[model samples]
Target chain A: MKYLRLVLRSFLRSKRRTVLTILSITVSVALIAILQSILATLNAFANNPDASNRIVVRHKVSITNLLPTRYADWLRQQPEVESVMGLQWFQGVYIDRSNFFPNFASEAEFVNTVFKEEIVEYSDAQFREFLRDRNGALVGKNLADKYGWKLGDVVSLKSELFPITVRLTIRCIFRSKRPADELALHFNYKLLEEGVSYMKGRVGTFFVRVHRADDVPKLIERIDRHFHDAVEPTYSETENAFQLEFLKMMGNYSAIIQMITGAVLVAILIVTANTMAMAIRERTTEISVLRAIGFRTSQILAMLMGEGILLSVLGGAGGLAIAWLLAGAVRGYVGTFLPYLQNFHIDAGTMSLCFHATLAVGTLSTFIPAYRAARRPIVDGLRSL
Target chain B: MSGEPIIRLRGLAKSYYRESLEIPVLQGIDLEIPAGGYYALMGPSGSGKTTLLNLIAGIDRPTGGELEVCGHTLNGLDDDELAAWRSTYVGFIFQNYNLVPVLTAFENVELPLLLTPMSRRARREKVEEALAHVGLTEWMEHYPRQLSGGQEQRVAVARAIVGDPELLVADEPTGALDHKNAEEIMALMEGLNRDLGKTIVMVTHDPKAAHHARHQIHLEKGVLDRTIEVNR
Candidate 1:
């Protein structure tokens, strides 16, 4: 504690250099925090705890391939399954092609059962109305709020994949735990099938809800085996695994992000190490004077390293504050393209990782230079005078 | 200035090496200065007077021969042990008055005491007393850059004596000072020796500064040339 003033004074000796170094670390660490938060958001999307009791059954070929609608009936008849719904992705655009969001043609009657975890709130009467009207649509709260949509508001979507323009009347607006899940709209599959002749008896996937989470594995095996020799083979997995498969289709995003983060960390380490080395080198005479005045080498080394760590921690703290302040804007901007990042914010785990990373960089970058400076012979140091 | 000498040297030798080539700076020398004696070492630039002062102060090791000062065998102590010994027994005032520029006079003087188990209050008190002794109590809050060359040297002197070490070694303490400041610093050193009974060993090329010492030991080419007792 007595040496703190000495370390601080030495650190502040070169104000411009110190501030520049700290800014470098701050910018780099902020970049790292944002990147790690994005990765964490994606991971949370792929590993949602609420998805444990749900399973997804898709065609054996690819996600784009459609499965027979009878597969949902077969899944519902299974003793382990509690509810099943056929879901078909409606790749559509609104007024502008840039205004894109996930729209799905879904079985309306079983939505409340199959996605019980997702539909946090909705009016029972509005849901019944959606079930009755062929053009009625169930919009997520975020999707509705985004487009200023309300009950009885008619919204039209032009689908390029299926030669049809379906005009849907918003009957219900539902909320969900995850923001990404609340950025979607679902209309009755009957409306889509009646408009497009080829999509009438086919679904992109079947989402099944089981009574018990433990029954999911067995139910998935049973469903796949039942359709193994059928005209279209089925691939069944837990909802979490399905989400992970979708993430995989994005081409090893996690590894790419991690590599980029690692590269940034290394670059910051080099810059910080150079700054510390130069600072210590500049104070060669001062260090020798301290040694001559009876300070031990270890004491000198500790003081130097303390200065480096203090610099890094200050930058790290600044970076975190900046990242936190900008998180909302990042979520809104990036989430437009990638819905999974709508829930993007720095989590506790990411904060901890960044904090530890700064500490490691501080310690590692300062060690060699501080040790060399401290271990230098006092006579040699004095000779510089 | 009788009884056993506070500093004793027998065949003290020091050498520097540059890639296997040896450069002998100080060759076989025998010397002693009794307790409370004020002496000066005077020689040419390469006469190795500063080297001898460094060795006696325990800042540098004698590569080949036995060296002892203030009852501790310096040759037997490691770097850390020597540092501990120096904190307790020896004080140094460099040619440049190497007070830490970032620290105030009080903090600079309080540095050596930080190595001890002294409380902050005690350290502050001792620093205040030391600065007062150098007649710079009013300037204790000032930094080295803010002080004149003589005042900086005085702060260096205060830092040297704050720990109450038995010996004080100065390497051209007033080399950078003008005539007036040099005289003032020499007077301060004289008072420290005469009134406080400190053993002072200083290295100086300035004949006027060397005249202030009780005895001057002249060295020529790493060997003692003569010892002259000054008739003050």
Candidate 2:
């Protein structure tokens, strides 16, 4: 405690050098934090709490390929299947591509049953109104508020993949337990089927609500086996596994994020090590004088290590603050491509990981240099100008 | 003003090497100084006067010889033990008044005491007394750069004695000061020796500074030339 002022003054001896070193560490740590947050957000999609008891069945070839609508009936025949819905992805733009949100064509009757846990604020009358009209749709509350669309408002969407326009009356606005779940719009599948020739009597996937979470894997295998000999075979898995499969198509980005984070931290280690080495080099005489004054080598090493840690922690905290502030902007940047990234924020787990990573960087960077400096013979150090 | 010998060196030797080629600095040195004795080591450049003082201060190890200071043999003690011994018994002053530039006079004086188990209040009291002893009581809060060369040296002296070590070793104590300040520093060292009973060993090239000591030892070509008892 008595030597704290000396440590701080020695740290700031070369202000420009210290500031630049801190800036380098800050940039690296911020990059690491932001990259880790992205991985966390991506992982969240597969771990959504609402997806526990659900499974998805798609065409064996690819999700882009359509499955026959009759597969929904076949899946419903399974003893463990409680409710089944045909869901089709409708890649559409309303007004502009920048205002994008998820739009899905779902079996209207089974949509409510399959997503019971997700819907937090929707009325039975509104759901009935949506069922009464073939051209009715339900928008999540977040999407409704984003576009300023109230109940009874007509929403017109131009399909990008198909040569059709979907216009429907908003019969219900639903809130969900998860913010990501509330950014979707679901409409009657038959309305889309009737309008587009390629989408008729077909769905891109089937969301099967299972009676027991433990039965999901067995039912998935049964449904796939039942359609194995059919004209269009089926691929089935739990909803989370299916989401993870889609993530796999992006080719192991989690590993890439890990690599990038590692590289950034290594760079930080090098920069900090170089800075401390130079600082210790400059203070060789002072260090020798301290030794001459009877300070132990361990004490000197502790002081230098303390200074390094202080610098790294300061930089890391600054980086974390910057990363936290930039999360919203990042969501805006990549949210359209990965719509499930809504409500993106740095979680406690990621922050904890970053905190430890910063400490490790600080320690590893200063260890060798500080050790060598502290162990140098006092006479030699005193000889250095 | 002397008692039993505080420093005893027998055939001490020190050598430097340049890529395996040995260059001797001090050789065949034998000396002893009683407790509370004020002595000066005088020599020209490369005579190893500073080297002998460093050996006596336990900052440097002798290449081959017996050295005993304050009743502890300087042989076979590890670096850490040597450091602790120095902390308890030896104080140092450098030619440049090597006070940490960032520290105030009081803090610099308080540094050596930090190695001891002294409380903060106790350290403060000791530091104040040491600075006052050197007439630097008013400059305790000033940094080295804020003081004159002589004042800076005085602060260094105060820092040396703050731990109340039994032996004070100085290398060119007034080498960087003007004549007036050098005279003041010499007088301060004299007071420390006579009033505080500190045994002093100083190295200097200046005869005037050497005159303040009770005894003088000269070294030439790493060999002792003579020991003179000054009649001051």
The pairs that clash in candidate 2 are none
> What TM-score would chain B of candidate 1 score versus the native chain B?
0.97
Put down candidate 1 lDDT per residue, A216-305, tens digits, no spaces.
888888988999998889999999999998888899988999999999999989999999999999888889989988999999999999
Scanning candidate 2 chain A in windows of ten residues, the lowest lDDT window is A331-340
| Each model's total of backbone clashes | 0, 0
Model 1: CA > 4 A from native: none
lDDT of 2 by residue, A1-385 (tens): 8778778988887889989988888888778888898899889888876788999989899888888898777778788988999998887789888778889888998888898887778999999999988989988987888778999999998888778888989998888887777888989989888998878888899999988898987887888898899888999888989889878888999999999998898889889989888888878888888898889999999999998998888889888988898888777666655776776788888888888988888888888989998999888887775
**TM-score, prediction 1:** 0.97
User: Local distance difference test, per candidate?
Assistant: 0.91, 0.89
* Candidate 1 residue lDDT tens string, B88-169: 9988898898888888999999999999999999999999999999999999999999999989999999999999999999
